[model samples]
Target: MFWIDDLWKFGISAFVGTLTVFVPLLDTRTEALDPIPVVVTIPILKDLAEQVGGPYVRVTSLLSGYENEHTYSPKPSDLIAVRKARLLFEIGLGLEVWISSLVRNAGSQALRVVTTSQGVELIQDDADTHEHPHTGKHTTDPEGNPHIWLDPANALIMLRHITDALIEVDPSHEAKFKANEAAYRERLRQLQKELSDRTQRLPDRRFIAHHSAWPYLAKRFDFHIVGTIHLQAGTEPSALHLQSLIEKIRKEHIRVIASEIQLSQRLPELLSRETTARVVVLTTMPGGVPGTETYLDMLRYNVLQLVGALETT
Candidate 1:
């Protein structure tokens, strides 16, 4: 009887393991998948994924707007998201370095890992390769720019990639996907007009960023990044670096010290105090903060924040 019980226990364990591997790929079908557990690293992607997935799939963002997306370390819940997710969408371009490890650990080959920036042909910048603010090669895409989302023009392209993946996973909602993509693109188009109109008239387009995070936006709006507090994404600024920036501030007559909500505002705040510059919080994603819940609102909020800082202080 003891032998029988032991055999039963072993068989149950083996069977459970086998099912876990095969069921989600084969038999496990849910009523709706629009909200499939999607693990995105950025908030804008989080919003976009939810838009494309609609009511059928559930989505989750691994990195919140409050932290640096480029320098984030993976958490346990992130691994859990990978384990449960049927399809994984990432920014790619080596944006999320921890992705490979998470995928391997989850051991789910059935999981679809889609790079949202696949077709954009990224922009390249090697001049300041001394260090990069993000992961991988110091200089960004030789093919094109990784910050494709900044250009609303590219968001239309991204929609195709996102919609195609959603379709592949769940073809039943093909029409709904198309409709959703179109609606989202139209909204983005309006946002492009709103952002472009506002930035066109600014007298001085010079600003200081903690890191080189705004090149994509700068190129479109004709804004210049005089210098970065920290050139590399993860490295902290040294005292010498701070002194140099203060000097740059005086020489350039730059008034706004821009800080991202994701990184340490303490440093930016200190620099602002030293230089008599006003500190502005910029959002890199949609719904990154409480107020900037949509992509349009996110860009507007960032631009408005910058404009306000430049105008008032």
Candidate 2:
């Protein structure tokens, strides 16, 4: 009877051990079917990926809408995110100067870098914008301005890139991805038309920009950019340039000065004090402001705010 009890104990122990090992294997298989990990340089790409990929992606954005994209420094956690990601989406055109080195350091051979700005017609700045003065590099691409996502039309192109990439990675979800992309595209077109109609009715459509970031937006909405405060990012305008802007604002009656939430408010505030032009703090990224948490929300908020300022002034 003692020998029988010992044999029963051994059998029970063996059964529990087998269950523990096999349970983890089953979990691993389920995890393999989990959402694809994605890393994007900016929030706009993250939003686009999530919109297109839906529940099929786990996306991480390196620069949360508040950071200056040109001057962003990657953190240790960013490397881990990149290493785990199968796809890394970037605005490209030299906007994210820090990304290439980060990816290299991550040493992820399985990672694929997708440039969302590819194939879209770019806007060449009449004057180049310098990178963060500390880095001593040109942030603006030699080819053109990399802020293509500012324009909803260009965002459509970006959405397409994300859609194609997601489909490539998860072919089983191809139909879902395409359907999501189509729905988003339709929403974008509808919003573009609505905003365009609103802007068309504006009596005054001219504004002085904080930086050379609005050409596409201006062109798309039929608004005019009278002057830019910072030709180079992360640097102050020369006294002479500021004086010239002041004079131009006074002379041209540029009632609205567009400034970004990501940049310092001191310059735009100073200008507002020196002139009658009101400063409207707008966001280039999706989550830069409280109400602007999505691409469509951002586009609407910016145009409406600008239009409201223009109409009031």
Candidate 3:
């Protein structure tokens, strides 16, 4: 027969042994259930986060593909997203003026804001030529133009920023994040090469941009931008500017006018009517146009559309 105290001790030991075995299992289950939450200002960033994060993160984008980045106002849901996110990615060249206020309003101490355009070389808008009156102030970095992602090279830099942020937050998944980034970059390079082959053989690559958003794209693929319709966002060009563009198009025999879907088609159409140039509508954001749901698809569509127009003209 065992003493009462000895029996009690044995029972307690057994309970402790069982708990020791189950505690780690419980921790593992909990960790698996909780994924890192991320928020991005634009759709492109959201896509990038998804590509890098894979199954480890949940991402939300504030602006859909059709919205204008320069003039977008934040919604109530944006604040809620920010409050829950561990990381918030933005382009941050004064492109998202509303983001600062949104983050402040959320007041999440743990949320980290990552600027993906930190290392990108900026194109300075010709202040002398690109000026217009505005109904309200637009956010443009005095340092340079904010539309850096249009260039594939700049996209690589943005990817690095995103990968680094993911690694910092979730070190355990560093290997996966790095691998995803590498694979994505390889795909980007391949696409760029394919597009370059298409554009390189073109006889004429000159076109008028609908807005001051094509400089980076033009520089990357050797396209020449002869003129821009809207030098400033939300401001109509003066009659004098329009007349000059028409005259220049006729004089230079510029055959194509590249218009963005996000902007009003009124000016591009008017210019097309006044001049002989054909309008080739393109999208700056993914999913703005059909077959452009992803970043790669958007790039291919824009390049091929412009190339086809240029070749025909």
Give the Cα error of residue 197 in candidate 3, in Å. Answer: 0.8
Name the best candidate (by TM-score). 2
The CA lDDT of each predicted structure is 0.75, 0.90, 0.88
Candidates 2 and 3, the one with greater lDDT: 2
Candidate 3 lDDT over 1-313, as tens digits, reads 5655765877977767978999999999987677789999988888888888898989998998888788899999999999999999999877787899999999999999999999899887765653421223333435577788899999899999999999999999999999999999999999999999999999999999998788898899999998999877767788999999999999999999999999999999999999889999999898899889888998999999999999998
TM-score, every prediction? 0.84, 0.91, 0.88
Q: Residue 201, candidate 2: how far off, in angstroms?
A: 1.8
Selected candidate, larger lDDT, 1 vs 2: 2
Looking at model 3, report the run of 10 residues with the lowest lDDT sum: 130-139
Clashing pairs in 2: none
**132-234: candidate 1 lDDT, tens digit per residue:** 4465454533533356676666666766787888888888888998899889888888877887788877877788887666777777667777878876778
Residue 56 lDDT, candidate 3, scale 0-100 = 91
Candidate 2 Cα outliers beyond 4 Å, as residue runs: 1-13, 16-24, 128-141
Worst 10 residues of 1 by lDDT: 136-145
